[model samples]
Target: MVTSATQVLFPERIYQCEANIQLIAAHPEQGCYVVTDRTPFHPVSHIWPDHPADRGTVVLESQVHEVVDCLVGAVEQESGQLYVGADIPVKRDEPGWVFVVVHHLAESIESSVGTKATLNVDEQYQLALSRGHSGGHLSSLALNKVLHHDFWRKDASRKDELGHYDFHSYAQTESRVTEDCSTDTYRIGKTLRKRGLNAADMIAALPTIADQINQQLAAWCEAGFPVDMRREGEALTDSRYWRCDLQEGVVVEIPCGGTHVTSLAEYAALRVEFQLINEQELVMITHSQPA
Candidate 1:
């Protein structure tokens, strides 16, 4: 039976730690996929796959293993078989499964079970990725606020923290975040138009929209609002939230499963540019400089 889900430490901005090796699974190509009792690695989401995995090295018996990639993984309670990202068939928190962080090491070794191990995440790369995530979120909020006045219809489904039409949540189709950069794609199809996005108007004003979003993002970063994640618990399966205080008395909270830096100031500058790749699709490219 599954007694515990892996405790995730990256949400707390932790970089290094020692933990007991829970399981050591073998892969023909990747070599060893190590699961630890606790880890600072932030695995890419199976559901979204937006933020990239954290990479570094883990020391086992004084031999360092290179962590090529990390993944959200799970083990079947009765079978003891592990499944990596997009391979596991069950939904999260399923009764017979345990969610885990799989540290994909480049080389495989035999007989390391229950061994004490030291995990050290690449701090610089992880911090840069964090800045990209936080900056993307900030850019979305700013875009939502700027578009609220003339973009959506009066009968909007959901609103953001600032009481604005949440175009980011409503229309966003896919998002990908990497080191110091993020790309957000939205579908402005007939359904969205019926729900009241001035698609034609927005297309016509792409440059202006980009300029407004960039200006707003620059201001928000300049204000240096704090960035944080609030977890329901330490378990990898627990619900986590991204929190920020954008303006005085205006705190924004989003249900997010990712890592971030201490504050917006960590991102020296943030900017977003918009593009209309097709008549029915919109894209936003965001970039941030680490401080």
Candidate 2:
């Protein structure tokens, strides 16, 4: 059964942890091992998954095992059953379930069940993904500002921190963040139209909207706004907000659960392009230049 208390080690930085490892099980068919306690690797979240897992290696008993994949694993409360990644049954932060990071080793180590092991995360890849995630957030806010004028009614309510109608959050159907950029898909269906959004007019003015977004992004990057993650607690399930300090003391806050650069100055430039995927769907692709 999954225990009530579990520890995480990635909140500060990704590195190798020299802690004792308990080999919970060995998948003979898959040639992988599962361990408990201490890992600097960040596993992909089962719910609201955006960023991918970290790649790295684990060492035990003089055997170096390449960690080909990392995933989130949960143990059952009553049945003592263990589930990994997409096989997880319940949502994250669910009560009576213990969450652990599972590092999929390339080969089985010589160590026994209770032997000590070390974990080492690939730092270069993690940094790239962090920059991409930050750029993704900035691009989304810029797009919201550019499309602010498309909302026909002032009484429709529900605007973003920048006073836009918040079409990014409201109309978005799926969002994915990659190593270089982020892709967001939105549905411009009847619900959005009923809320006083004119999709046809917005699509016709796509060029102007794109220009506006690019201009805003350029200004933000030039200003070198400070960015940080505000967390409610130190735990894995704690609520976190991505805070960006813009010009004129304006701060934008959005809920997020991912790593990012310390400041906007790290980005040399940022740009976004909009494309119409279908009659009632839109795609926004964000690009970031490394500093």
Q: Pick the candidate with the highest lDDT.
A: 1
- Which candidate leads in TM-score? 1
Compared with the true structure, the alpha-carbon lDDT of candidate 1 equals 0.86
* TM-scores, each model vs. reference: 0.95, 0.89
Error of 2 at 157 (Å): 3.2
What TM-score does model 2 achieve against the real structure? 0.89
Tell me the tens digit of each residue's lDDT in model 1 across 162-216: 8888888888999999899989999888877888888788788878988998888
Q: For candidate 1, what's the RMSD?
A: 1.6
RMSD of each: 1.6, 2.5
What shift in Å separates residue 102 of candidate 2 from its native position after superposition?
Answer: 1.6
Q: For model 1, where is the 10-residue window of minimal lDDT?
A: 1-10
Candidate 2 Cα errors over 4 Å, as ranges = 1-6, 77-79, 110-114, 248-250
Residue ranges of candidate 1 with Cα displaced over 4 Å? 1-3
